[model samples]
Target: MKIRPAVRRRSIRDRRDPLLTALTGLMLLYTLLPLAWLVINASKTQEGLMDSFGLWFAGDFALFENIATTFTYDGGVFTRWLLNTLLYVVLGAGGATLLAALGGYGLAKFDFPGKKAVFAIVIGAVAVPGTALAVPTFLMFSQLGLTNTPLAIIIPSLVSPFGLYLMWTFAADAVPREVLESARVDGAREFQTFFRIALPLLAPGTVTVLLFNVVATWNNYFLPLIMLKDPAWYPLTLGLDAWNKQAGTAGGEAVFHLVITGSLLTIVPLIAAFLLLQRYWQSGLTAGSVKE
Candidate 1:
């Protein structure tokens, strides 16, 4: 059968969506250019870093050696910092995600007096910048003799108002009241209904919240700067900052190289985490797009 001219014209128009294709390409480049540069730079030595092209790999790849030195430098202090970061990210972010999930679920599902006021407070909390709160938190922790402790970092991290808001918004639409009522009708307790039915429904939002908190805590520096003075308790961000400062002094350029390399390494876990959890985000986004 011969194709109609009008149908052929529509096909051409669809293929010629120049604005969309250009925007997509631009966004892809924006996201990927930094990562490409980091990988290329990680392969270079100190001299190669200084003398070579900024966006390309070096002739002599020292990536393996740099990785070794990064881990073993300063009596393996970098490893300690890495472990501390892992602890903070896992405990602080993970705890915060769970709390946010529960809180948001409760706010979205339950009816109570002053619910609006409580939600208003949450929105206000989200608006307040973390940096503005750091000094006051430090003073309070100092009075309690909690300064320079991991708890100082972990405690504040556990209060993610934004995560709570996100989950609350997501749960309001994602979870059906009929399902909860059905679960209750089937003899399921409230807690069991939440855990078995609601939580599973909230998986995508939960993963998104977890990833945000994890990245935020992992990269956090200002709060730690105010709360912590001991090097032993320093997370990767603070530890890298210290290394960068030392690198500025005489005979410390080697430490500078290590710091850059360490920064690159620090991001690997974040990338891995996003790649792993992105499927959940995709599923969550698509879940309500089409209705039965």
Candidate 2:
């Protein structure tokens, strides 16, 4: 009798959620529609792009040609931009993640002097928009002669207040102090206790921070736009913008197809990264729930 009542209530609740499901479906459609358009049009030649409906494929598949031209154009400058973007992702996001992990762990576990002041400042920094600091950052870097260098971009990308906060909160909840005490009793040093036990427990929070930092660093534009002038230091966002400008010129070759194709190519690696890391991400999100 009790099971029957519970099942009936669940069914009623499910029926009542149709509006929620419909809203979710609508949101998915809205987000995916632009991506679908990009893929469809990327397959078209310049003439095909102009002649055919953007939602459908053109008569000739020009995706390979567009890709070849995108890479080979201007003595293969796009390849240089690709390599530069990868370098930024590696040095920038990687260092940000490492620093956030160490700092978050210490903040969560320790009771050092001035800790409250540090926390307040970090929380306040999170409220200040990065864009608002861009001009000051540029001016500071200019004085130091770091402008137009990889260090200009990589240095600023290392700071992620939100990432640090997320990890701190996660460490507080996910890692118990009793475990640290036990490790100490077993004669393990503080760093060993952290590396062997706490770091594993903090995996999910770390991945969450890492993914956000990676995406932020990958898509960053305004800072780099102000900081860098040399084409050799250009990341993909600025490089694509330059290509876009050329496409819009009155007397230049309309490489609109290349722009669209390059845009499509740019997102592929990010999607792949998300898919690759999703398993770890999911496991991390569920880490403390089982209480094992």
Candidate 3:
């Protein structure tokens, strides 16, 4: 039996699709190749890292040894940096998300004087890069004696205009005015209605806002570099930069492996956090995609 022309064309298309898919897979691997090298290099000793292949693992797996040295070196200052990062992540991101929620809810639900002006200011703020304000922020914190303190990082991280915009956009669609009206009809107080009714609906938005803030604060380097002089107060990003600098200098090869290992470890928490919270973000994205 001979195959039909349509069937042969369909088979050709199907075969071409696999080739296209393989090309995409290869591109993804190329993109991720550097990270793979980081992981492989992190597991090797200084000599192994210098002498061995970049893509393959070393014969002696020194991951645990590198981790120990990373933590204990400089009197376990890396642990302090890790703690500082966690504090910044929780306080900065959490506070920013809360404020974004309140601001967004207010913008969405209330009709008030100067609302347009307020929104315009927010949009303008969003356009301004965070780095542009770092110098002024440092001066302000310096006057207040907040430089070198965790507040120096957390305070700035809490003022994310992008997060506010995202929440505002989400609230405009996800939260229904009829629901708020019904709550008012039942004699629910404004705060009560917001906490009970609006907040639950805003969960997905809140999660997304939190995730963005968390990642930004975690990867923050420039602000901390300008604000903090004390190594003890360093976040992981600043600490890693310091390590990278030292690794390039003489007699720093012993700590080179530790730096690579620490860099790998630093990103693990962020990956875990996103993996855990992604469902809420995914749902929030699709929540208002369809209308009744």
What is residue 116's positional error in candidate 3, in angstroms? 1.6
Per-residue alpha-carbon lDDT of model 1 for 1-292, expressed as tens digits?
3678889999889988997899999999999998888888887899988888989887999988999999999899999999999999889999999999999999999999999999999999999999988889889998999988999999999999999998998899889999999999999998899999999989999998898899899999999888889999999999999999998999888776687789899999998998988999677656555657
Supply the global lDDT for candidate 2: 0.89
Provide the overall lDDT of each model, using Cα atoms, as 2-decimal numbers.
Answer: 0.91, 0.89, 0.90
Q: Which candidate is the best by TM-score?
A: 2
Worst 10 residues of 3 by lDDT: 283-292
> What RMSD does each model have against the real structure?
3.4, 2.8, 3.5
lDDT order of candidates, best first? 1, 3, 2
In model 2, what lDDT does residue 145 have? 95
The superposed Cα distance between candidate 3 and the true structure at residue 135, in angstroms, equals 1.3
Check candidate 2 and list the clashing pairs.
204-284
List model 3 lDDT by residue over 1-292, tens digit each: 3669889999999999999999999999998897899889988999999889999998999888888888998999899999999999899989999999998998988999999998999999999998889889989999999998889988888898988888888899888899999999999999999999999999999998888988999999999999989998899999988988898899876778888999989988988998999999798767667877
Cα deviation of 12, candidate 1, in Å: 13
